[model samples]
Target: MATYLITGATGGIGEAICRRLAPLHSLILVARDQAKLDALALTLGGSHHAWATDMGQDGAIDAFTARMESEQVTLDGVVLMPPQPHADDNPMPTPDVWRHLFQVSFIGPLALLKGAVARMNPDPAEGRRAKIVIISGISSAQVLSHYATANVIRTAWVGEAKTLAFALGSRGIHVNTLSLGGTLSPWYRDKLEERAQKNGISFQAQLTIETDNVPLRKYGEPAEVAIVVEGLLSQFSDHMTGLNILHDGGFTRAY
Candidate 1:
């Protein structure tokens, strides 16, 4: 069985990804909370490993990469899910905000990818398969003034993924980005509740307002997103690379 490293593995969608991939792949769960990681590893009931590290910390990513390399571990795949920002209702973007965004969204994931990709077979003739799936937000493609930091960093991250796809494709690695719409996960539940409270409306009312923006007229479920993620990580997408798939329920009319 292939081994996959998943960052932010404790979050809603992250945990969904873990559940979807657990039966087949050996997981290396990376998250900020050690207790949560331990809980998830136990729930998964597998020989999975858990690494507790905060991506926002300066040396954390470096340490993770170094440890994996020194252990001579080979990663067949990597699933990246950056931690969700807390109540990004602020219109003004600060330097600290940008720094944190870049740290979790771009820098840390990039470092991990470098290490994971290095462990993959470089010889195409060897037929050793490898995949990298990145979960980004709709802000990557659409403009959300409140999510300015995310918009900038996510776009940059997608660009880097494309570059890496080309850099690694010939060596038998595929890299892709899944730009998502609002999913009714724990992260969005908190965000929606905050927005509703701010707007002096009920949670369900706020949910309706948000879903009205989507052509599908509803929020996506975690399992729905997980299925697509599974496809990207599996052999089904062997011919695909450098693709940015928008899984936003037609919220953005960007054809």
Candidate 2:
């Protein structure tokens, strides 16, 4: 069985992807929270394993690579799912914060993909191609002022994925990013509640206003996002590389 490496596997979308993929493939779940990872591993079945690592920390990629090597793990695919949202009263976008966001959104994914792509052995005997899937935000296009750092960093990640797709296509490695819109996950619900409280509006009122803005008139479910991720990782999407698949329910106006 092919092994898939997933970062930020404790978060909403990430956890959804893990649950969706774990039954079919062996999963290596990476996150900072060991307890959460362990719990998720047990719930997802015994085929899933957890690796505790802070993806935001320096040298983390190298350390993770070493661990995988020691365990004789060769990854056939990777899912990059690092978190990027900031609640109220967090630090502003200073140079240090920008650097950290860029590293998490851009640098870290690149490093993980580099390692996974290097280790992938897509022989005819293996019967599968290697893939790299990144979970980014719609802010790459929508210039949300509150998420300026995410806008800048996710754009960079998209650009980098394009280049890597071209560079690795000849080796049968696919690279693509999924730009997500509003998904009704626990983290998003918490964020909405927090924003509503700050704005002096009821949570239902806030949802009503936001849904009115969406062309689909609803927030996407975590399973919807998971379906998109699965499609990107599937053989049917092998011909597609370096593309950004937007899952925003037609909320973005830009062509």
Candidate 3:
């Protein structure tokens, strides 16, 4: 089985991806909480390994590579699910907000991708061409009411992925971004509930209003996200590269 590294392992979408991939492949679960990563590794019931490191801080990617080198582990693919912006990441963002967002969302994650791919491709022993799937939000491609930090940082990642795809295509590496819309994760649920309270409406009403613009009129589930990740890392890579595939249930209106 191929070994894939999944960053942000304990988050809603990350955990779902792990569960979906575990049956067919080995995993390297990455997150800041060693304890949580260990617990998740156990639940998946496999020969999975866990690596805990804060991808937001400086030198974090270097340290992760050091550990991987010591273990002589090479990756066949990656599923990068960087942290979403916090509540303070508003439109007129502060300096601190921008710094934190850039460090965690953009620099750190892309650094890890570079490091991981360095150990992959150009080696015949590594087998199939490597795949890199970056998980992001539709806000980067389309305007949202808020999410200023997400808009800027995720858009940068989209561009970076395309650039990387161009540089790595000849090396048998595929780089792409999965732009997501609303999903029924805990975080989104809380946001919907909060909006519902402010508008004096039921949670269902809030959810419907939120998804009204989506052609499917629905929010995606974490499991569905996992399925898409699996495809991109497998069949879809044969001829596709550098594309930011949208998983928004028709929520995006822009071209």
- Candidate of highest TM-score: 3
After superposing all C-alphas onto the true structure, candidate 2 shows an RMSD in angstroms of 2.6
Return the top candidate by lDDT.
3
Give the higher-lDDT candidate: 1 or 3.
3
What shift in Å separates residue 189 of candidate 2 from its native position after superposition? 0.4
**Candidate 1 lDDT, 99-165, residue by residue in tens:** 7777876777677677677776635576678899988888888787777667777788789889989
Residue 233 displacement (Å), model 1? 0.4
Tens-digit lDDT string for candidate 3 (72-162): 8878899998787644446887798778788888888878877788777444245468899999898769767667768888889899999
Please rank every candidate by lDDT, starting with the best. 3, 1, 2
2 or 3, greater by TM-score = 3
TM-score of each: 0.90, 0.90, 0.93
lDDT tens per residue, model 2, 49-128: 79887766658878887778788887888888756755322436577876777676667766766766767776534556
